[model samples]
Target: MNTKFEELEIKLETKQAISDLGLIDLTPIQALAIPKMIDGLDFIAEAQTGTGKTFAFAIPIIEKIKLVKETQSLVLCPTRELAIQVYNEFLKLVKYQKDILVAPIVGGESYERQFTALKKKPHIIIGTPGRIIDHLNRGTIDFSKLTQLTFDEADEMLKMGFKEDLEAILQNAPKERQTTLFSATIPQEIKRIAKEYQNNSSIIKAESETLTATKIIQNYYVVKKEDKMKLLERLLDISNMDSNIIFANTKREVDEITEFLREKKFNANSLHGDMKQKERSYVTSNFRNKQLNILVATDVAARGLDIKNVGLVINYDYPQEDEIYVHRIGRTGRAGSEGLAYTLLTPRTEHKIKQLEKFTKTTINKLEIPSEKIITKALENKLIISLKKEVVANTNTYDKIINEFEQEGISKDALLNALLDKLVPSKKVYEVIEEPKQKKSNLSDFDNKKKDRKDSNRKPSKLKDNAVLVKVNLGRKDKITPLIILDMFGSIYNIRNNNIGDIKHYQTYTVVELSSKGHSFINNKTFKYKGKNIKIEEV
Candidate 1:
């Protein structure tokens, strides 16, 4: 059992602030770790995400921090987003503690602003490892008086290749200070950090009975890597998601998915660690405000985001760890509302679902990719329902206009056909997309696509016959194979590896033959390789 916030040995202001946030009882990690950390003992905590580990460490930092402000506490995080989020939480909890100042030091923000904030001698420094290390080297930060130290998400920091920076930062900090390292999982490197850096510390695990939310209908699709995007678009169109999140593993993937969705006329944007704070704030605000309906993001949005009312989550790429999977899906199905999570898996990664299922202690139901016809029928049903709602509205003016059209020999059936044609799309969005079994998009897709089109000296081959042949700038000189060209087509256009017939590569361009069925895959629409516009024209 955990004690109430009022019972904790803390200042009246701190207690009042915690109470104001509607937090009555302490979380398991807080009850276990706070008392130990407040006692000035080095501690190692293994806790799951969203288990109140923030408050666990924050409460102790507030209780033990002195009024004399010269950087008394330092908390290092893996990413700028987490650092900013933690800083915001402290800002709220310390609302009544007027004199105790805190500052966030993260990359992608102005150094002059950080220099100004550091000159104020803030009592708490919440920052990413890289920025903190830079400030330390610039002599702008004085951790000599650091009385308390914490490595929040220690596992992530190490995974981000920040071990050297961590060692350097730890070395510069006062050895006599109280230290605590908190992580969702305890890997060997995290254990090594605890052993090498801290005094004798005790381990505390805050495991939950269930790893994920029961309200989330978790499902995995064993789709090929090339077909993931096609299936993603189909699901979004038919599922009717509101403010949904699409998670990808890399920043490049984030950009690619967001770009692809936008090209297909979905209201979507990308979020990742590489974005500036203002850029991130804008994207999140738009998402939270419902101005943007779909958010294509990296795992940076998973850890500490406060956005609510997510209707669905789609993992464009599966994470290697169960913790990342939990956090990714945790963005949805919050506050008792039901949500759906769909994970796309390739043949090689199909077994990882078993691993995630074992770790989460829940069955991950297998999902089938809905065919194009089914998705179109579902969308048409929605259109019919929406149009039926108009039957109740007063239509005297429209009826008179229709009467005139009837007099002009246009049948009511003809009018209905016109409305249907105008209201619904003529073809499925995935018609031009190639669903494939193997091959993936390159990291430099956007740049390479544009460069190959714009800067190349090659010209389009003249049509010798009505045969379907498309000429592209990438050829032998670009170090591309026939399979590579087919994969590129598979990634964007709706064709398969078998659909591509003969491939003749020259120094400047490659001419590819498409079977008669795949000829319709060529389009003049602004197709996006990765947010940039490209086109495939018929020869």
Candidate 2:
């Protein structure tokens, strides 16, 4: 039997909010934690990411909050991204209550803005430990009126060396407050925190054995690192996915991948720490409103975000942490809906797959990279489906055109083929390359060579006849170093260190010699870094 949110004894407003968010059924974590939290009991929940953990606590906080002129609930997260994400989720839950106010306190933004928000006497406070502690030290925030507190991603916080900050906040907070700690994994530090702070806390464990929802179809493809983007593009072309989030390891990779996707005519954006708050919000809003179909983001930038209807999650680069792998794939297969997660792996990272399987307690099946023929067939099938829909909607209109063509001495079969050709243009699909049998080493040698090149004052005129002088629109003024430019080009074009040529830097632009082939590959393509389009042209 399935449990619904309505069955819980929450306020009608909260119930309405849940319905507004289109949440009909309660997830396992929510089902187990909401009641205990509403009863004002302390809790220590072991729930994985994307398990609707935010709502497990947010709904109860909204139901029990008194809407006083002071902070009644305080939620602490590990990073500013997660803090803002939690604040946004709380806002959704309190949409029906006009009197309720929430504020997010995190580092990286102006302190004056936080001070102004604190002066408003928000009913709830959401922030990271460091920023929250900063507010406490300045005597700008008071927790005397706090009735409930939550440590979201508690294990991550401790791992980030926030034990003293957490202890300071807990010491100042009222002991009678309802405390809750939620973590994906309960390390010894988390256990210690729970033992010391929580009073008779109801320990609820949503184990990793069921961490990944059964609805998610997980698969991985083994390919060379250089061929990752090519494989990714092929998958995107053939998968018929409506919405996707591609995870990369660094901000540079996120920007480069997003730029590549946009060049391919994909409605894509990037989210990373380097982006300002406004830009991040804009990208997120566009994604939510369907203005953007793909969002390339780093793990930290995407934490605690709950975007709806994400049909696919692609790990373009394997994550360093096993837990992060879970969170990356967890973005899909949400809200009882079916989703697909694909990971691109190389021989060097193939062993991580087994570790991931053990950590997630779910089998990640091996999948062969799709061939050009397979992709072409998939594209044809999609076009046929679309043509069928069009005919079903306006059969009479198409029938008239078909009759005219038939009367003009055109056979029905020929007319149909022409229409199909027009609907789905014929294009050359790249074939999947087989992985080499040789053992591949890490990129330390490439990194060392890049570092050496960056430190050298090389001139562009010394390049070979095959090299072309290319100008890029970013320079030292924009904090664009030589290595950054190299990384951008290398990531987008999958070029090696030797393929690059001489380089020169300027105040507002840089000129570099690229192999004629490399120059042609990106000749008319749009490339972006830090959300700014890089205008490239051969000099």
Off by over 4 Å in 2: 1-4, 19-25, 106-117, 160-164, 200-202, 207-210, 259-267, 395-416, 429-432, 438-539
Off by over 4 Å in 1: 1-3, 273-282, 300-304, 372-539
Which pairs of residues clash in candidate 2, taking residues 3 or more apart in a chain or in different chains? none
Displacement of residue 196 (Cα, Å) in model 1 is 1.8
TM-score of each: 0.70, 0.72
lDDT, candidates in the order shown:
0.79, 0.82
Put down candidate 1 lDDT per residue, 148-239, tens digits, no spaces: 99989998776666777999998999889988999888876677778888899779987564357778899988776777888888889878
**Alpha carbon lDDT at 514, candidate 2:** 80
Query: How does model 2 score by TM-score?
Result: 0.72
Scored against the true structure, residue 251 in model 2 reaches a CA lDDT of 83
Tens-digit per-residue lDDT, 23-46, candidate 2: 888878888898899899998898
